[model samples]
Target: MRFPWGPGDVADLPTVGAGVDTLSDLSRSAEPPGVRLRTARAQARAFRAEFALTGTPDTVVTCDLVTLPYPTRFGLFRASRAIAPFLSITNRMLVIRWRDSDGRPRVLLFEPSDVELGRYTPYFDNLARKTPGVLERRMVREHGTVLGHLARLGIRPDDVDYLMFDHLHTQDLRRWLGTTAHQDDLDARPRAAFPRAKVVVQRDELAGMAELHPLQRPWYQPDTYRDVPPEAFLPIDGSIVLGPGVAVVKTPGHVFGNQSLVVNTSTGIWVSSENVIAAEALTPEHSRLPGIAKWARGWQQEVVLNANTIETTADQYNSAVLEKTLADRSQADPRFLQFFPSSELTGAWTNPGTTPTFSHGHITHGVQPV
Candidate 1:
């Protein structure tokens, strides 16, 4: 599909292959799981080499959105029982400044998690009911708003030309993109978060929100899109290249429309998504955390998922492999992979056995335009 703004026709750009483009392709593929994974890995390596040749983005920054208590079982894919019941997951917002192919500057915001509406998600709603203000009290907001961050960078809301997310889970689109219908719950009319930005999301993910399956219902807030105008979204199938060194590729299994942001930087290529909550989870064999390596070795699993639901477990596993393949090895710690989780697991006294052996605290590359 051609974007009305920003970079034009993604179809005209290069691709790894049609087979690895979409989740449906991977799901219905006739090739065996191992065979498909190996093949995709090989392709990704070649693609990574080619991607490295592209110019790096002007600036890339990750800001804290909000940190909340998350289930330990799901975070580690039930690999351990010794960890705290809940671990803190700091959801982040990644902002990138880059020059389009035409050499015009552009801004892209990835994973702008709406803290307010996020609490209303079924899973959090249930947690809130069990203990009122407990979830609220535990929530951390040390980092300011996305708008505030943009202002510090001298970017107006209208200056943002593109917006994206790893997936649509827990996001409330009504506020991000103004709705045509009135929102009685808000008790006020909501305007677009970034007046001119076009939301680039997976086409399938948007459809999944229309009628969520029982398993997906808990993690998603579909009603958030109830009144959002269709024109506000730029739904594309499979993988797409937004500009130099920036791509959003389908990374299915976490959810139907799940995708990951890949950006080529001076340090190397960095991938962002919630496929794995911790860096050690990617290189499980070398994990220092309790039960991770043992579980991976016992199951012969190469990667541990940030598992919530397992309906698409295998697909999610393959997608994580794809991410590992695409990302460059970390310079700080070669043992740990360069896959940065959108919601990274932070080690604190409150949550034991959840500390990551290696953490890429935040990425800072180049300078945002003044």
Candidate 2:
């Protein structure tokens, strides 16, 4: 299932055609925000009904990466005036096994690396420096590493065909891709985690690593890539289908090159991103969380963003709409849509007033090869 395109090339990648482009174009166009949003929803409905009927992946597992406290304001888009300053969240990695249209099995690791290095980001760094109990009590890893998960599942490093993150925030690529020059910052000599895998990231995110805006600088750890080779990245534009039941589409506004992972499962379709922290966000009207429904109703807004950085607020709003339109309603709770936030808000007694109305917990489908 090897892609024909080389590093930094998407020439041979299977694209989603005009549907993805139309949604993105409408976001950036001068059309009224309401008009564009409505149009985007219609387009997404058509896109899903017409193009998202691909076969389900052979297996899909959500691997817990880490658990940490994030600002509640950012998690709920500052819409809530809740007393809690921070919300507990679990950052997860998706290990997906699927066959391409040619019937070749492929292994993809989505959001599988460098979450521990998030402490170096300015926002988290400042919190660690100033907060009393954060470094000791709040930041904890109760789960295994990505490599360990793969090993237990009988997957070798080289067995991975592709790697990706929804966006570049808090990622340090040196460990995953390896560095050509020695990096004093890394604890050990950096080497490739998946020797044969290419990072399938968006072109804009790849470029932003080198030239970050003032607002973007806090979220990215660009120094990690200072010594990494250019050939380690396979940058793509817009949306692309990686294999049956799996696609990555641009969902900008949270970051310049933000994307969301869309997949078909035995139950239905699911969309994953940091766009919305809770499943209730896509259907805030059904939410019982304080200030969430009130805020949305007061403002006449349908979607609430995970606005750690709102580079493009309108685009972010529209992206959430697109995600909602693309996903299937949850089978467990029909009130919620199956849009899983990459880092989801979890219930923690220590973090009050931040419990999500509904948490999908994790997605598991099919048996893995022994």
Candidate 3:
């Protein structure tokens, strides 16, 4: 199939290829924001071990699996699984990790769980209400598969040092609330399973979240928001550095406070935690339908704060252009690869052959075995 966006259209821009060679240059670029070293070797070993387990040593990693779901529509005329003539749901998490020059490790994480509705039959109940059921099942299956694979790789849970929450969506909040409410309930079992690592969120993001929705104020734990000391926050025009090696760039048009993480890994600069668009959306050749573009843009604004800030202007413009270009194409016309970093790649033992590799723009070689 001819992709709406493909090579030759924007030859000057980078083309993401396979293996370490493609990643070499980009990896060597300036490190990402929010990373500083107090302990070097300890961090390096942790990073290397995590990369070996996850399989994405230099790029973003997405958790969960993509699969078909039942269709329906909920409030605001949105298509829910119940409304779909047929439906499918695919969910995943965004993961990032890096190893310092000496092999110390740093990690970043994002939540990508969503109940996608399709096929149009118009179910009466709100689709969001039913989404948890679908998501719960998917998470259970995915978590089991991921854990088993990691265990075989000799990676234990304690190895992780950072867990970034991209944003707390309704689904995520629901899961947390449910878990806290019934810590012992069998159905609520998933709540107690968060990774035992430092849970991090942007200080401004946490504050904005509280201001936007008062009710949610109680949802977050007091300790969840750790403001990077003033010295740690970088103030670039389009981006803000959170720490020594970690920078959070505003990539709006997806969600308010939608940001991306730039980290320095052993390989090079890894742009992980992108929230402006899906992995395919960033590729020069792909395009999105007009309706989807409008919906996505609107959704981002409605969900996040400071939606119109200048930081996201470029991303917003680019995403809008792509959406218009592919307005006529069906969703399947585009090969959508969800964005992920090197950390979550650890869950790929189930399909050893199809596993992804990391590289800078020049390399197209296959990934090295962990």
Top lDDT model: 2
TM-score order, best first, reads: 2, 1, 3
Query: What CA root-mean-square deviation does each model show from the true structure?
Result: 4.8, 4.2, 16.0
- Write model 1 residue lDDT over 247-329, tens digit each, in one string: 88888889877889999988899999999998778899988888989999999999999888765888889889989988888
Please, what's the RMSD in Å of model 1?
Answer: 4.8
Give all candidates' CA lDDT scores.
Answer: 0.79, 0.80, 0.32
- Kindly report which residue stretches of model 2 are placed more than 4 angstroms away from their true locations once superposed: 1-24, 133-135
- Tell me the deviation in Å of residue 54 in model 1: 2.1
Prediction-by-prediction clash tally: 0, 0, 65
* Candidate 3 lDDT by residue in tens digits, 188-263: 4343222444444433443344343443333223222122121211112223333334444333333344445444
TM-score of each: 0.91, 0.91, 0.41
- Weakest lDDT window of 10 consecutive positions for candidate 3: 16-25
User: Any idea what lDDT model 2 has?
Assistant: 0.80
Please state the error at residue 74 of candidate 1 in Å. Answer: 0.5
